[model samples]
Target: MDILYTIGAVLIFAPFIAFLLVVLIARKKMKYQSIGLAADLTTFLLFFSVPVSIKAIWEIDITALVYLIAILIAIVLLVIEWRQTKEIEILRYIRQTWRMYFVLLALAYSSIWAVGIVLSLLHFFRI
Candidate 1:
């Protein structure tokens, strides 16, 4: 039962994790290659799966903490990347694209949160 719950959580939150990694960390590379994007997305999914699974098993209230930490880390990384790679044109492009990325990420997060809430309500009502 625990394992199944873990898997479900992982399957739920995979895409948002992928978007975070590719947008925040890999955006500075010169290549902007497809392989890098795939790798980051894979890594994001893998890491995200584990934590979500653990949370499901433990019944943790991590909603605020997770978003807070993610937003803080994202801001820090963006500031650091901007400061360190000011001369790179790719970074400029990444900065421009980040707006779209955030919008998509917000939409994904909201959808996931809504689904989770609905599921929890259903479970509570024994539906």
Candidate 2:
């Protein structure tokens, strides 16, 4: 159980590394498959990393905040689509919301890492 927990924690915290490893393994099997695998893994990893990244950089737990924001985004998108098309499209709403989360989370993850790296380097140089 302890080993399982350790592995899970590592995967959760080091999503980008895990993503690369998975992509490389998939690539060895099939080039086309790897492309799709990479896309899927990126989104999946972002879901875990977004909250972890936000917490690391901000020193605040944003796990619940991310979910709340996602719900709000879905609501806003549904309203706009309904007003324009005069219909409720569940599938389209899901796709748009998912893609939005992926884009936003990817940006957050990368930016947080960039800021962390910069801060670390600055601190190291100061000493």
Candidate 3:
């Protein structure tokens, strides 16, 4: 149990490693490049990990806030799709929503790391 938690913590803290591992595993099964598939998987992984990472770095849990933002974005996208096409395409909507979440979460993950690095530097310098 402790080992499992340790591994989980490592993966959560180092999502790039997780991403690379996914790509490597996916490549074994795929003849073509697996970057896209790996990215999608990493994005899904980020959806869960980003909030935890943010909490760890900032000492605040924003899981509910993050989820609420995703939902709101999806709802807005759905409305736009409905207005443009005049019909709801479930499959397309789902794909678009997923892509949007990937972009959103990826940006959040990068921003969190950047801010964390800055904070660490400031603390180290006693700034």
The number of clashing residue pairs in each candidate reads 0, 0, 0
Clashing pairs in 2: none
lDDT tens digits, residues 32-120, model 3? 55776767777777877899988888789898998899899999999999999999999889878887888888888999999999999
Instruction: Report the C-alpha lDDT of model 2 over 1-127, residue by residue, as the tens digit.
Output: 9999887778776766776777788887887677555655677777777888777767899888888987888888888988998977787777677777767877778788888889889898995
Candidate 1 has a TM-score of 0.36
- Most TM-score-accurate candidate: 3
Q: What order do you get sorting by lDDT, best first?
A: 3, 2, 1
Q: Every model's Cα RMSD, please? A: 12.5, 3.1, 1.9
TM-score of each: 0.36, 0.73, 0.86
Residues 13-122 of candidate 1: C-alpha lDDT, one tens digit per residue: 66555555555665567346644564445544534543464366456655566556556656676677678877646665454444434444455456556767888898
Better of 1 and 2 by lDDT: 2
